[model samples]
Target: MRLSLISSIRRPGFRVRPLLGFWHRWFGLFAALWLALMAITGSAVVYYEELGSWLNPDLRQVEVINPALPPETWLGAAKAEYP
Candidate 1:
């Protein structure tokens, strides 16, 4: 089957409506500002996790104990609950 691009083909004599032209221009400004805000916020959100880790030292802090918990302790607890 052959697909037609009839609607995409521009008709030679174009009629421009005055009110529509005004509306387009009016909405165009708002659309541009909205897109700009989206771009800025999107970039900020992308780096937000990395920035948070860098900014908050408490979140990055790790408690160092002399010895780590033995695997037997976790295995015994798991067996007690699951078995």
Candidate 2:
């Protein structure tokens, strides 16, 4: 039975050939549209940080910081900032 099914698919002028072609074209068309949307969404996510800074100018400002602070002092500053 399986051999007959396989032979039917490979046979010339069989109904299965056109059915397979129709499915292939349908899937390819939908896949292309899905791929395009994914590509655009991926690009937006990849530049999310830059886009966020561009949209919110306040986040783009820089401040000078003292990097020489000790670990304990940094921990205290972090606690104060969060608390």
Candidate 3:
């Protein structure tokens, strides 16, 4: 009776064409979301160093030249320390 009709619709090997379209649509939607996420994160990584320096400028500062011992004195220290 009515059960036979419902069984035929739900039978094995029955092709539901609309579900195929829905599957493809959802796949495309998720792919686009993944792509957008990658693009945003990629941009953030590319600018990470600049962003860090800007946020903490004190850590990126260069001081004026300071007086130092002569090269001979540095070489003597190096010889004593390394050799």
Candidate 4:
């Protein structure tokens, strides 16, 4: 079966050439457009974080405070605030 398939491909006839040509033309025609779209989407995904930070600079640039304060401090703060 493999031999027959390979032989048929190698033989090259009107049928195979036209079929291959049609597929080649169609795929080639769409390849550039598909690649451009893929490139744009890929770049967007890669720079998503940077883009988000650019849009919301304040939120992204805020300082991160240490939350390792003593338990007593937390309890006192919570009680003072809630009570």
Of 3 and 4, which scores higher on lDDT?
3
Stretches of candidate 3 exceeding 4 Å from the true structure: 1-14, 62-83
Candidates 1 and 3 compared by TM-score, better number: 3
TM-score-wise, the better of 1 and 4 is 1
Error of 4 at 64 (Å): 12
The C-alpha stretches of model 4 lying farther than 4 A from their native spots are 1-16, 58-83
Tens digits of per-residue lDDT for model 4, 1-83: 99998787775544677889999999998998899999999999999999889988898665759767888999999999999
Model 2 per-residue lDDT tens digits across residues 2-79: 999988777576677778999999999999999999999999999999899889988789776955778899899999
- Top candidate (TM-score): 3
lDDT of 1 at 83: 100
* lDDT by residue (tens digit), candidate 1, 1-83: 12446545645576558669989999999999999999999998999988888889799888887777899998999999999
Q: What range of 10 consecutive residues in model 1 has the weakest lDDT sum?
A: 1-10
- TM-score order of candidates, best first? 3, 2, 1, 4
Estimated TM-score per prediction?
A: 0.50, 0.52, 0.53, 0.44
Residue 36's lDDT within candidate 1 is: 100
Which residue pairs collide in model 4, if any? none
Clashes of 1: 0
Model 2, CA-based lDDT: 0.90
Give residue 10's error in model 4 in angstroms. 16
Q: What's model 4's lDDT at 32?
A: 83
- What local lDDT score does residue 9 receive in model 3, on the 0 to 100 scale? 72
**Backbone Cα, N, C clashes tallied per candidate:** 0, 0, 0, 0
